[model samples]
Structure formats: C-alpha cells, structure tokens
Target: MLVSKSAIAAVLALSCLVLVKPQVADAQAQRARGASAAAISYEEKKRQTSDIAVTIVTSGITCTCARFAEDIRDIVNDLRPDGLRVLPVLGVGGLQTLEDVLFLKGIDMGVVDEDNLRLLKKRDPALFANIEQRVHYITRLYNNEFHVVARKEFKTFEDLKGKKVSFNLKNSQTEVTADAIFGMLKIDVERLNYDNNEAMKKLREGEIAAMIVVSGAPQSALSRFRKEDGVHFLALDERSLPNHDLGAVFDNYLRARLTHEQYPALIPEGTSVPTVANRALLVAYNWPESSPRYQRLAKFVESFFDRIYQFHDGSRHPKWKEINLAADVPGWNRFKPAADWLARHKGALQSRDGRTLADLRPAFDQFVANYTASTGKKALSPRETEKLFIDFTKFLESQVTSQSTR
Candidate 1:
C-alpha cells in the first residue's frame, strides 16, 4: 500500500501495453483474412475463364448420329476435363449439320456423313469451292449402311427399273447416295420424296416399288417390319457397278452385308444381303490457330482422344465400336490441332525405343516411298498415309501402355 509515484507510473504503463497488444493482433488477423479471400477469388475467376463449353450439331432426334452425340456429351461431362462441356444440338441431318458448323454463329462442331461433302460440292459447286479446306474432320464415326427395301416382286436393283422409289426427304443422305448409285448404274427410277414413315406406308400400299433408308445397321424404323410384310432388302451388286475411279462417289462407299443376325425377324437365317456403306465424320470448322476458339477446341480434342476407351466399353452406343479415330476421310483434311496432337504422340504410342511421334516420321515416310518404288503403283494419299501411321501408332500404344499398366 506504500507506493511511490514512479511505481504507480510503471503499473499504468504495463496495463496500457497489455490492452493495446490484443488490438494490434486482431487488426493483423483481419488483414490476413482479407488477403486470403482476394487470392481465392482470383483463382476462381481464372478457372472459370479457362473452362470450355462447345456445342456440337447432330442429326434429328431419331438418328443414331444424335444418340452418338448425346453419348459423347455425357462422357465429356463425366470426365469433366478442365470444365469441358459438350452441347449436342439436333439438326435436320448431315447437310444441315454441315451448314450449322460452317455458317451458324457460336457453333463449334458437327456430326456429318462423309458423303455430304460430295453432295454439297455437287449441289453448289461455287458455294462449296475449297470447302474441304474450310471444314476438317476430328474423327470418323460409324458407317451408315445403304438399305434398299423393295416389294417382293423386285428382286434386284435392275428389276425395279422405271419403278417409283422414295429416297426419304430431298438432300438426305439416302437421297444423295441413292441418286449417285442409280446414276452410276443407269437405273432410272422415278424418284419420289417422302419421310421414312410415309415411305413405309407407300411401299405397303404399292404406291412406291421401293424405298431407301441409309442409316446405321438395325435401323429402328426397319426393325418394326414383320417378315410377312413382303418386303426384302435388294442386293447392291458391287460387281455390276463399273470400276470406281479413285475419289469418286463409289470410292467412299464400302461393301457391307446385311445379315439375319442383325435382323432376325426380317432376314432369313444364314442369308446375307450385300449393300454399300458411308461413314459419319465428326467435323469442325477450321478456326485459326492463334484464336481462342482454336485453343479451346484443341483442349477438347486432347480430352476426347485421351479418354476414347470409355466410349467403346459397351456402356455407350453400340455404334461406338465402329469408330476409328485415325480413319482417313478422303478429300477432307484433319483439324490442325488434332492432327498435330496425334502426330506428336505417334512415337510414344508405337515405339518401345523412347522416341517421340516426330522421331518416327522419317521412317514412315521412307516406308511409303519404298512401297511406291517397289510396286510401281500410285502411292498412298497424304490422308491415307496419316491414317496408316496412326493405326500403327495405336497398335504400338496398346501393347506398350497395357504392359506398363500391368
């Protein structure tokens, strides 16, 4: 209780120091929280900006093209690679899909039949001049089998000469392919235009002798038909058709068979019907390499190719099994970014010698050169060569990647 003035001053100063220390600490903590919040906001903005959302135009609701598009959309969404989002739009068909990708604003890609390129060229040569250079394929999808269903009276394409036939709607894949096939064979049938259902009714009513449906095998529309309906698939004899000139309409069409296995109720057991098929292609407009759109698309390509196995695992559409990512689409070029990605990974995929894809380019080129020199025949086209190179690379990747994983 006996305190001096210096002791009293010392006690007051100590109290002041204790009170101010907590205030200063609280202020510092508040500033730290503010700085952390700002850093988090910046990161979120960067991530959103880096995300890619693209729309792919596909065929109408009933088409396998649309189903394939939806499957891709789901797979890409599931993978969620860097926020990649795929939007599949339903268009009229292949031609519309092409027009959407080419002319429509904000459209990134389309699912089109390879034959549509030829049809576009023939229909509007001026409009489609250098079209191949404008539109590029990402990958080749499944084949569309050409189905020529006829009345029992018409056994072969020749027997139905001068008879009325429906090629679905005008500018459709069936119409384009049927016209070209008929023109090539000199079989002049009175061409009629009708929807698939209407054409089916007409065929049953004897209004049309035959109808053509160009779609993937086991077409849903045709599956509804009963064997007692008296309709049969006409055999497209490749032998009857003249030798096709390279890069012609006949060139893209492959010889395919329709068997009872595919249509048990319609086709008899152990019987097969011969027909032609055209491939569907996933094509994109050639955006400039320097543009943001191109970069975004390139990201999508890498994600798609890297996870392609998911599409073929039987969970997706059955048509996915037919997809050959490296298949060649004659007369069309590949998207630069996609082609470059494939090329860069080619060596790693195929060679056990630790070489990059670029390292194997010279050997691939030499092989082509040697083959042409030895056989005295025309060499593979640039697209064909790229396809073979990719195929070989894929084979190598399977062996090497599988072993490494094990």
Candidate 2:
C-alpha cells in the first residue's frame, strides 16, 4: 500500500489502541466482578449456607477483637455443642461492629468498645435511642488502652499543642476516644485521619507530632517501633495535667497503665506510662426471647461461660485472663439471656474459681468485717480497701500460677 510516513504512523497508533481497548475493558470487568463478589451482603452469604450457628463481627485481622473472636470460634469448634458452628467476620472496627450488629443481617454478635455506645448517645442521640433498646451486651471483655505515642521532644501531651496528630480512621475507636479526650483537655491540635500503619509512618517521618491508638496492648503497630525511634507514650494522669479537671468525662474511662514489660522496645524498664482505657464489650442484638435466634444466642452464652476457664489457661490471647464475665458494664444493659444465666448461676459465677475481679469481693468484704469487729471502729478507707484487695488478688494469682505449674 502506498502511504505517507505520517499517515502510516497514525494508522499504526489507532491499531494499537484498538487492540489495547479490549484488554483494558476486560481488566475492568474482572475488577468489577471481584468487587461485586466482595460486596455481597452477609445475609446473602448466610443464605447460601445452612451451617453457621452464629456470626460475630469483629475488627481488622490485627486487632484484639479478631483474636478474641478466633479464640471463641476455636473453643466452640472444640466443644462442638450440638454441632453448633461459630463464624467470625472481620469488619472496619468498633463503630462498624456496632452498625453491623444493629443493621446487618446474619451478624448475631459484635465486639465493640463500651464507650462507643456512650459516644453515639452523646453525638447522635436519635440514632442511639433507636439502637440502644435493640442492642444489649453479652459481657464486658478486656480493656483497650488509650495509647498516645509521640516523639521524645514532645514529652507531655500539652507539648503537641497546635501540631498535627493522627487519630486514625474516622469512626474508629481511636478517633472517637481522641475526640472525647482532646475535647476534655481543651488542647487544640490539627487532627489527622490515617490508618494505623500510615499514622505510624507519618509519626516516624515527623509529619505528625503524635498518634492516638486505642487498642489492646501490645498494639502490633506500636510494637514495630524501636527504642531508638524516640517514640514514648504520653501519660494520662488523673491527679494532674492530662486528665485533671476532666470531671464527668473521666468517668467514662478507667485509669490504666502501659508497662514496659508489654512493650520493652517503646517503654523503659521498671517504668509505666499512665493512660485511660475503655472496656470492650461483647454485645448482641436484643432478640425476642421467643425467637430461635434468642435461643441460639442463649445456648452460646451458656457454653461460653461454662468453658471460659479454657480461655484463661494461656491457650488463647493473654487478654482472656482479664475478662470478668460477671463485671457490671456501666450504662449498658446485659442481654436478657446472659442476665438470666448469670442470675441462675450467681454463686458459681461469683466464686473465686472464676477469672473475675468479683472473685475477690467476698474476701474483701470479710476483711472489712473482721477489721471493723476487731477495732470497734469504722472500716478502712476506700483507698486502703482497694490496696488490700489488690495485694490479695496478686497473691491469689501467684498461687494459681504455682498450682498450674504443678
């Protein structure tokens, strides 16, 4: 064919595009299919199978929620209670876990922070009103420490004033907690939203002055930091600076400490960083007592409480040792089935044999009684009582360790 060089070049270019168009379209189509598959609702997936007895919506794979859920799944699998099956599904985090339990079908339970419920009530009263009645807690799980990590130069939380700080993803537990905490402190800062890994990167790169992480320690994200990284935890003190004059806001959190033992790389030996913590709750939708779902959940609750000892024997996440199935979670109502179960087995559940702080109550009361009877005076102060209880608990824990080794 007789053709000018320019015309030939143009023709070849058009031919190349024509050949590439189908490949690009095919790639896009494949991606669309994959996304659609991923987006399939949990209900639809559940309908495709008849085996799943209960599905728990937890946080990302790296979170404590995921590990706790997996442990429950394992326990259920081992016990094989009437062929019941447990499925743990990973979700966005605490906020999403709450949403999933409220709206998503096939989500029988969720792992959520107790403070999230309070936040919802404070931030969106209408929505909280609608869901609060619908949802109830199974039990209060372990505490998630509020980790405030900053460069060594920013020794105190006040030092990060007006600097960029990462609160992690919006609606995450970290973000919600940071909002409440920073609001209480009245310390203004440029708030940043990034995933855990990204926030850590920005903090290391000095793009952000500090990052708040609300998770079970040793947070894998913070664990990656080396001692030379110059990252240190900001202490949230009740008597001074960080938490001083916080008043009612302080009631939402418990005074907690992050020990060097848990994160030797980020913390110095024999020293601890004080911080606030929120308890994670195993919550469930309040299914009617007459429904099959309610019965299934009740059965699951029974099995879980019955075999909780297995979780405490170092077979699962260390946090399991801290779970107090009988502990009262302030401002939240227990699920009816769980409440009834606790009521029926009150003595056993409250006994020293269980892994709960309540186990020490009887001894504490006896000590108070004996002291008052002997001294012919008033009982010990609350502070003294707590100290004695703590000391007694430590001795009991040591005895448990000693016996287990034998």
Candidate 3:
C-alpha cells in the first residue's frame, strides 16, 4: 500500500511512544519509593518527638510555675530515645491561663491560680459552664499568700478602706484576687494598678495608702523592704476588720500565717502575721482517653510524680517543699492518669520512699520540740505541723546528701 510521508512519520512516533512507556514507569516508581521512605522517616521522628511531647502553659517566664515547668522539661525530655517531651509556654496569668488551656490549640495543660477557677466561672458562667468537666487539677503546686503592705499608721486591712491602694498592675494575679477580696468585703478602696516595684515606691512616698501583692512568701519586692522602713504587713483579724464577713473570707481563702523566717526583713522573730492564701495549681485539660494528648499527659504524670522528691531539696525553690504529691486539691477532680498513679502508689502502705506519714511523726515532733526550745516559738498547729514536717524532711535529706557528697 502507498502511504503519504506524514502518515509514515505518525506511525513511527506511535511506535517510539510505546517503546518509552516502561522507562517512564520505572522512573516514576523509583521516585515514589524515595517519597515513601522519606515519609516513613518523618513519621518515625514525629512519633518519637512530637507525639510524646505535651505543652504546658505557664503564667510567665518569671512565674514560679514556669520555673517548675522548666524543672519538669529538664528531667522528662530524654533526647537519646526521644522520651516524654514537655514544652513550656508563657501565658497570661489568672483567668486567662484557664481560657488558653480550654480554647488554644497545642496547649495540653496550664498552671493557674485555684481561685481563678471560681473567678472565671463567676465572670462568665455560660462561657465556661462545664469547666469543671473540661479542666482537671494535676496538683496544687504552692500557696500564693495575700500580702497587704501598708503604712504603720494603717495597722489593719480595714484601715486602707476608702484609701488609694495599688493592686500590683491591671488584671495581674494580685489585682484579680485583691479586687475580688475587696469587692466581696464591700470595702471601697480606690484601686490603682502599678507593678510592685513602682507601687512600693508610691507606698513609701505616701502616694498610696497600701499596696497588695498576691504571691508566694519571701517575694523579692516585699523581702527588700525592712520593718524599719515604716511599712508593715497588715494583719487581718476581727478587731481589725470589725464589720466585714470573716466567714466568707475564711471560706474562700485558706487560713495562713507568715513568719519572720519567710520574710526576715519585715516580720519579727516569734511573730506570725495573720493572713490568707490561695493555691497555685497545675491543671490539665480533660482530653479524652482515646486521644494522643491524654497519652502524652499520662506519660508526663508518671515522670512528674515518680520523681517528685527531686523538687523537695532545699536547693530547689523553697515552695517546692510545699507540694504533697498525694494531697488532693480542693474543689477539683485530679486528672485520671495522675489519680490512677497515686491510687497505686498511695495504696495500703502509703509509701513515699518507704516512709509513711506515721513513720515521720516522731521525727517531726522532736524537730518541733528543738525548734520551739531554741526560738521560743509556740508549737505549730496540725496543719502547720504538716507543712513544717515537709521542711524538716527536706532538711534531713539535704544533710544526708551533703554528708554523702563530702
């Protein structure tokens, strides 16, 4: 058959296309295999690091909780095997931390003031309706004492009524609690917002009658001031606050006393100024059991509680000694994994390093006896005894460690 030149060229091209098909397929397969290997490696790395990681939001870098979180991350994240990773994030304190944990993605937990649990609910009932179900306490970390520094003439908290008072900056944890306390008590103080440093200057200059700071005791701002400075920590007693509802106050706050040991510059030896304190809580969102977040939190919980004693040394923050791992936080259910771990360890023996509460009583009593004899201070109450015993145990541990190291 006679064929045109164009038809012959088309037939030749079709034959060439068929011959190259297998080569194209082989290259495509090679590229796909390479992609699959890379994907597998990426997934493996993700499983080791990101999958095991849990992010915990803290109030701020300087916040006690952030320091504690750093302590956790340092111990928990095992680089060799890519073990449990704790990522600490800075958050706005008080109520905001709670909201961040609830709503922000990548946040597994938060450190918050316990009072904020109620305050947030009180502020927006509908918004955080089931917050109880949504958030759970891993533990109560430390006590944030309500500090009221006033002029010597203003001897009591009530004396500051109708006076200008600094609540330690706007929407700060100090201001939040101070506002709540004053608002609840019906005290009509003119509220001012200034950082403690500036407020302290203002107080000394008589620019403000009093300044309130809610923080762990021995706070630097208060510690720097001397009793000779004409400023004092106001006592909150019935005689001082005659008409206010002390019942409501006590109900909301934990009864506490600040001693000279905590703030040597302000409080005199053998003196304990009456005060109230709220708890700093490490809280976790109630992630479902089926979720990867829950698994990561569970691993973090195990590492935290098991090595809990690491925080109790005198070398660590003095506040670290305050945390009783098995101690249940008030008004909050513990995270399930934490509760389970405690349930198993806090079993019949109640073994904390093979020493139960009963085992420590005699040692505590003797220390108290020696302390009282030397300092001429009165014996502490049951609650105070428990807190004292924690300090005593840490002291003994440090002494042992020191002797061993030597």
Q: Give the candidate number with the greatest lDDT.
A: 2
- lDDT by residue for model 3 (147-213), tens: 8998888977767778999987666787788887887777889888887678889998889999988
Candidate that beats the other on lDDT, 1 or 2, i.e. the better one:
2
Off by over 4 Å in 1: 1-51, 78-82, 238-252, 347-406
lDDT for predicted candidate 3 compared with the true structure: 0.75
The lDDT of model 2 is 0.76
Worst 10 residues of 2 by lDDT: 1-10
lDDT of 1 by residue, 1-406 (tens): 1223343234333433443457788999989978865776766766654466777887656677878888888766532325677888877665777888889998899988887887788879999988898899999989888999999998788878889999878766677778787777777888898888898888988889999988888777887778888898988764534343323445657888888977787789999888888888999989988887888788789767755655765577677878766677788899987887777655353356555444555655675566557757566665455445545455455555566678
lDDT of 1 at 325: 67
lDDT of 2 by residue, 1-406 (tens): 1113343234333433443457788999989978987887898766534443888998767788888999998876532224567789988886777988999998999999987777667667877786767889999889999999998899887888899999888788788889888988888999999888898888888889999888888777788889877788988885448445766556778889999888999878999998888899999998998887888788789767756656765567888878878888877888988888677555444334443545335544575566557657555565445445444444444444455479
**Against the hidden reference, what TM-scores do the models get?**
0.70, 0.72, 0.72
- List, in order, the clash count of every candidate structure: 2, 0, 0
**lDDT at residue 223 of model 3 (Cα atoms):** 80
